[model samples]
Target: MKSWTLTAKLYVSGLTFLVLALTSIGTTLWVTWNLEGGAAAVNEAGRMRMQTYRLALAASTSGPSGETLALIRSFDASVALLRSGDPSRPLFVPWSEDSRQRFRQIAETWRQLRAQWTADRPTAQDAARDAGRFVALIDGFVAAIEAQMSRSTTLLQGVQLAMMGLAIAGVVAMLYAGYLFVLNPLARLKRGLTSVQRGDLSTRVEVDTLDEFGQLSAGFNEMAQTLQSLYGSLEDKVREKTARLEVKRQRLADLYEASAFLAKAPSLDALARGFAVQVRRIAKADAAAVRWSDEGNQRYLLLAADGLPAALLQSEACLDTGMCLCGQRRAEASIRTIPIVPDPAVSMGNCQRAGFRTLISVPVKLHDRVLGEVDLFFREPVALDDEDRDLLDTLATHLASAMESLRAAALERETAVAQERALLAQELHDSIAQSLAFLKIQVQLLRDAMRREDAAAMNGIIGELEAGVRESYADVRELLVHFRTRTNEEDIEPALRTTLSKFEHQTGMKVRLEIEGHGVPLAPDVQVQVLHIIQEALSNVRKHAGAREVVLRVSRTPHWRFEVRDDGLGFDAAVGHADETHVGLRIMQERAQRIAAVVRVDSSPGRGCAVTLDLPAAAALEPAAPALGALA
Candidate 1:
C-alpha cells in the first residue's frame, strides 16, 4: 500500500462514512417508492369488494341474465388480476402461507357461487344469497394486502430513523477516533512539556505509534533525557554548595515554624515551654531552660525547663540578675558562651560538676528590656559558628515578639471592657438617673403639700411621681435590651423583631415590622450594629415623637438596608440625626462606622421620621467580626 499517513487514513475513513450515509438514505427512498404500489393494490381490492356485492344483488333480484352473467365475469376478472400480482405497479401481497391459502379459499368460494347461480337461474335465490360468504373471503384477502403494506410503511420509517442514528454514530465515532489519534497524544506531550518547564528533568513521553504525534513524543523524550544528564552532572559539581544552602533553608523553615507555634501558644507558660523545646532541638543541645526576669532585671524566675537535670533545676529555680550565665545583666553581657568546668568550690554558682560541658545563653529581649532568657547546655564540647549564633538570635527575637503579642491582646480585651463600662455609666446617667431625680423632686412636693393640708396639690404630685416611675422602669428595660444585644448572622430578622416588639410594648405605640426583598443576612457583627441602630431609632420615636405608629422595614437589594419609620411628631432630622443633643445618635453613628455602614434620617417637624441604615454590598459577604460585647 502507499504510505499510510494520517491524512490518507482520515480520507479513507471519511469516504467510508459518506458511502454508508448515502446508502442508508438511498434504501429509505427506494422503500418509499415501492410502497406506492401497495396503495394501488388496496384500491383494486376495494373495487372488487363493491363489484362482488353488486353482482350478488343482480343475481338475487329479477335482473336480466345477461347483466347477471356480465357482473359475474367482472368479479372473476378482478380475482384473477389480484392472483397474477403486478411487478410493474410494484404491488404484491407479502404472500405468507396463510395469505396464499386464504386467497385459494376465496377463489374456490367464488367459483362455487358462480356455478350454483348459473345452474338454475330461476330458482337460485338461496345459492346466490350464499354469495355473502364469498364476499367475506374477498374482504379477508384485501385485509391481508393492507397488513403487508402497513408493515412496509413501518419498515420505511425504521429505515429513516436508522439513517439518523447512523449519522449521529458516525460523528461520535470520528470524534472518538480523533481523540485517540490526535487529542490524547497532544495532551500527553503538553503535560510532559509542562513538567519539564517546572524543573522535572526526568519527564518522558511515550512513543507508541509511528505517526507525526508519535515522532513528536519521541523527540520530547530525547530532549528530556539530554537535559536530565546535563543537569545531573552540573548538580554533582555544586553538590557541596547545594547541601549548605539546603541546610540554611531547613534552618530558616524551622525558625518560621517555631515562631508560628509560639505566636499561637495562647498563654505565656505555653509559649515558654514550646520555645524551650524548639531552642534545644534547633541548637542540638542536651538541655534547655527559659527564665523570666523582672523589669528592673534584679531577679529571674524559671518559667520553663526541658531536658534539665532535676537537681540543678531545683537548686537554680530562682536567681538574682547576674547570678549565673543565663541571668547576666543586660549592659555587661549579651548572648555569651561559658565553659562549664568541674569546680568543687563553686557549689551553687556553677552546675556543681554536672554532665554539661558548655553553656550558651541568649537574652529573650525586646529592645533594651530583657523579658526572658533561653539557656542551652550541651553535654559535648561544641564550637559556635556565626550562622549558629544568628539562628539563636532569631529564635530569641521571635520569643520576644510572642510575649509582646500576648500582652497586647490582653490589653485590648481590657480596653473593650473599660469602654463598655463607660458607655453603661453614661447611658445610666442620661436615662434612669435623671428620671429618678424628677421622681425625688415630685415626692418632696407631695410631702410639702401633705404637710400644708392641700388635697389637690398632693394629688397632682402623686400622679406625677407615678408617671415618672413608669417612665424610669421602661428606660431601664430598654437599656438592658440594648446592652444585651447578641445574635447570629442568620437571626437578623428575629433580633430586629424582638426589639420592635419590646418598643411597642413599653411605649403603648403600635409598631409595624415589614421585611421585603430577599438576600443572605448580614454578618453577625453587622447585624448586631443594625439591630442596635434600629433600637435607637425606635427609642427616639418613643421619647420625642408624639405619633401613633412606627414601621421598621428591613430589605436586602444586593446590599442590606434597614429603615425605621415613625408616625409621631417628627423632629427636624436636619437638626442633626434625630436630636443629636442625645448621645444615642452619636452611638448609632459609631456603630455604623465599625461595620462600614451609613446612617441617615429623613423627617419634617409635622410629618413622621424615617431612619435608614445602608450597609455596602461588600460588607454583607464579610465573615462575622470578633465579638465586642454590646458597647452600645
Candidate 2:
C-alpha cells in the first residue's frame, strides 16, 4: 500500500493522543468530584438529623410532664427508625468503631427517658442535666462532621479547577506548537508547489530544516530544470523538421490542384492559364509565363503568364523570339538564361514597360515530346537550383496526364449517349407509332362509310372512329410521357406535382396539396422510382373513382410519406384485387414493392379511397424538370 502523507500521519497522531489524554483526565476528575459530592450530601443529611434529635432532648428537659415530653419522645423514635432503616439506604459514619458505639448508646438512653415521660408527668433535675450533656455532645459531633464535609468539598473543587486549567493550557500549547511547526511549513510548501506546477521552474521552497520536506522541495526544483531544458531542445528540433516538411507539402498540393483544373479544362487555353497560376504559387516567383512549343521548334508561342500586363500576354510578338526560342533548342536537362528586350512592334512604344531584364525559361517535355516552356523573369539576376528545375519537370508531367484523361472521358460520354438514343428510338417505334397507325385506319373506315350514303353504317363507323381515336391518343400520350422521362436523372417532387396537376386540370377536380418537413435532394435513381409510384397511384384514383375533391399530402418525417385521398365513389380494394379491371392498381403495388416502400389503399363500396405510400427518407428526392429531349 502507498504510505500515508506525512501531514496526514502527523495530524492523526497528534489528535488521537490529545483526545486520549483529555478524555482520561476529564473522566477521572468527573468521577472523583461526583463521588465526593454524594458523600458530602449524605454527611449533611445525617448531621441535620442528629441536630434535630439534640433539640428534641433539650425540649424534653425543659417540660417535665407535659405534651412537649411526648413530642421529644416521638422525635427520638423517628431518628432511631431512620438509623435502623433499610440496608440499601446510606447511613452517616465516622472512621472509628468507638464513635459508632457512642451514637447507639445515646440513642438507647434517649428512648428510655422518652418512655418514662410519655407514661406520666415527671420532674427530673438530674435527668435534665444529663440530657443537656447528651444534647451538647451530639451537637459537637454533628458540627465536626459538617466541618469535615465542607473542607472535603473545598479541596475537591480546588483539584477539579486545577485539572481543567491544566487541560486548557496543554491544548493551547499544542495549538501554538502545531502552528509554528506544521501549519506554517505546510503553507509554504503548498505555495511553492503551486508555483512550480504553473511552470515557474525557478520557484523553490526555502530550506528551514534538514528534513524530508526540504529534500522533496530540492528534488522538485531539479525535475523542473530538467523539463525546461528538454522542452527547449525538442522545440528547436521540431521547428527545423516542420519547416522542411511544409515546403514539400505545399509543392505537392499545388501540383494536385493544377492537375485537377487541367483535367476539367474545356480547351488548351484554359489549361495554359491554370498552369501559369500553379507555377507562380509553387516557384514563389515574382513573374511567370508559359510558352508553348511550335511545330518542329520553329517558333515559341507565349500562351499564358501571371503578374504580367494583359497587353503583353495578348500580343505574341511582345516576347523576344531570340531568348524565348532558345529554351526549346537547349539540352533537355540544361537551364539557360536569355535577355528579354521589349519588341517595339508589340510593346506600343511605352517608355515605362521596357525597363525589365533577365529571363530564365525552363523547357517542358513529356516522354521526349517537347510540349512547352515555362519562363521566369526577375528584376535582378538570380541563380536557379536543380530543385527548381525538377519542380517544373514534375508539373509538366502531371499536365500531360490530365489532358489525356480529359480526351478519354469525352469519348466515353459520347458513346453512352449514342446507345441511349437508339433505345429510345426503338421504344417510340414499337408503342406510339403502331397506336397512331391503327387510329389512321379507323379514320379511313369512317370516311368510306360516309361515301356509301348509308346513315346507320355512317353513324356506326363514326362512333368506332371516335373510340379508336380516343384510345390511341391516351395510349400514345402515356407512352410518350414514359419515353421522354430520363429515369436515371429524374427528380421526385416536380414529377409528383406535374402528375397531380395534370389529373386536376384534365378532370376539372379540386385537388389540393400539403407538403411538410425538410426536403433534401436524393440520388437520381431513387427519385425516378418514387415519381413512378406516385403517378400510378393518382392514375388509378382518376380512372376508377368519380372523386370531386382530392387531397395530396407529401411529408417527410424520419421517412417520407405520400398520402393521396379522394372523396369519390369507391369499391372494395379486396374485390379489385380478385378482379383485374384496375391494372394500374397492380402496377402501383409492384412499383412500391420494387422500391421497398409501403402502400396502403383504404376504400369501401360507398366510401372514398385514401392511398398512402411511405418510402425511406434517404430515397425521397425533389423532381427534375424535363430536359430538351423530354420536350421533343
Candidate 3:
C-alpha cells in the first residue's frame, strides 16, 4: 500500500517467507521423529524370533532350571518392548489400526511360547510347535512397521519439495517488489540528480510513493524550484551591481583628475575654472558657478564658471554672504538642494527668472572653515542622491585647498619684499648715511681752514675731503652689488669666485680665495646667508681694516668652515666689538644665526682682523629644506 513505508513492506514479505520455511522444516522433523520410533519397534520385533528358538531348547533340555528360566524372562522383555514404548531407547510402533493388531499378535504368541518353555520337563515336539507360531507373528509386526516408516519418509520428502517451491516463488515476488519499491525510484532519482548537477535547475523527480525516498524526491523538487526562481533574478542583480561599480569608477577618475589639476594650478582663478569645468562634465549640468569668500566670510567674489550666461555671471560676480542660495552661510558641511521658484516679492531671486528650476550649492570648506561654494543650475528639475552630493562636496574641497595655497604664496611674497626693504634701509644707515656724515664734518673743517688762510691746514682738509668722496662712492657701489646678487644651491664656488673678484676690483687689493675639503654643497638659502656674512667681512676690511691683501679661506668637511682674513690696520677685538664701530658686525651675526653658523672676530691693535665662521658637523650632514630661495 502507498501508506506502507519500505520498512513495513519488506518486514511483511520477509515474515511470509520465514513462516513457510519454518512450516516445511517442522513437518519434516515431525515425520523423521515418527520414523525413529517405528524403526526401534521393528528391531525389537525381529529379536523376539531369536528368543523363541532359545526357549524351545531350554524346555526340552531341563525343566525348571535356571538357564531355562532366564530365557523365559528374556522372551517376556521382548514382548513388553513391543507393547509399551521404550522412550529412552526411542523404541515404539507408529500407532495405527494395522500396526496395533500386528503388535498384539506378536505379544500373544510370545506369551504362549514362554509358558510352554517353562514346563517341568517339556517335550521337543511341543516346543517346536510353539516357536514356529511365535516367529510368524513377529514377521507380521516388522512388515507393518516398515510400511509406516516408508510413509513417513515419503511425507518428509514432500515437505522438502514444497519448501523449495515456496522459496523459488518468494524469490520471484521479492525481485518484483524490490524493483517497484526501491530500484525504479532510485534510478529515477539518480537521473534527476545528474541533470541538476549539470546545471539544469528545471529537472525534477516524480514521486509515485509516500516512502522516505518519495519525501526526498518532493524536497528535491522544491529546492530546484527555488533555485530556478532565484536564478531568474540573478542577471538583474548582477547588472545592478555592475552599474553601481561603473558609477564608483567614474567618480574615482574624476576625483583624481580634479585633485591633480588643483594641486599644481598656477593661480586661484585658474584652479577654480578648471575644477568648475570638471564638475560640469561629471554632473552633466547646464551651468556651473564657483565663488571664493573673503577672509571675513562676509563678501564673496565669483571666481569662475564654466557654463553660465554672461549677464548672469556679471550680475552675480560679487555678492554678500547670506544674500542668495549659493552665497548663504552654512552651519554644517552639507550639499544644499534648492528648487528655484519665481517670486516677485523676493528681491535677489534671479535663478527662476533665468530659466533654472533646480540649484545645488556645495560649500568649499577646509576642515572647519567654509571658504566659498560651487553652484550647479538646471533648467529642468534635477534629483540628487547621496553619491551626487558627496561628489559635489569633494570638488568643493579641492577648490578650497587650491585657493588656500595661492593666498599663502601671495602673502609669503609680500613678506619677503618687506623684509628686503628693511635690509636695504639698514645698509644705507651702515654705509651711505655714515659716509655723508663724514663728508659734512670735513667741509666744516675745510671752511675753517680757508677762513684762517693757513696753507698747510687747507691742503690737509682738501686732501681729506677728496678721500672721503672716493670712500662714499665705493660704499654705494658695494651696497648695490650685495642686494642684487643671487645664490646657487648646487654649488657655492662660482658665487664665491665672483664675490672675491668684485671685492678685489673695487678695493684695488690683492685677494686670494683658498677652498678646502668639500662635500655635499650648501642649500641656496644657506649659501645666501654665508655669502652675506663674507661680504660683510670684506666691507669691514675696506672701511677700517685698511688691508692691502685679503685671504678668504673656505672648508666644507668634516664641517663647513670659513675665514675672512685681511692684512689691514686691525682694531682691538675687545674694544671694537660694538656693531656700529665694526661695520655691520651685528648684521653678520644675525645672518650666521639663520644658518646655525658661529661668527667670531680675532684681532689685536696691530694684527689684521679675521672673521671666522664655523658650522657644526651634525648640522652639515643633512641640510634643512625650507625653500632654497626663501632666505629673505
Best by lDDT: 3
Local distance difference test, each candidate: 0.79, 0.63, 0.82
Clashing pairs in 3: none
Tens-digit per-residue lDDT, 574-601, candidate 3 = 8745455466788788878767789999
How close is every model to the real structure, measured as TM-score? 0.51, 0.36, 0.74
lDDT by residue (405-502, candidate 2, tens digit) is: 55566665666566447645644554446657766886787677778877898788777767767756765666555545444433356766776777
lDDT of 1: 0.79
Candidate 2 residue 594 C-alpha distance from true site, Å: 7.7
Ranking by TM-score: 3, 1, 2
Q: Which regions of candidate 2 are displaced past 4 Å?
A: 1-264, 267-386, 393-401, 404-434, 437-455, 467-499, 514-525, 540-545, 567-612, 620-632
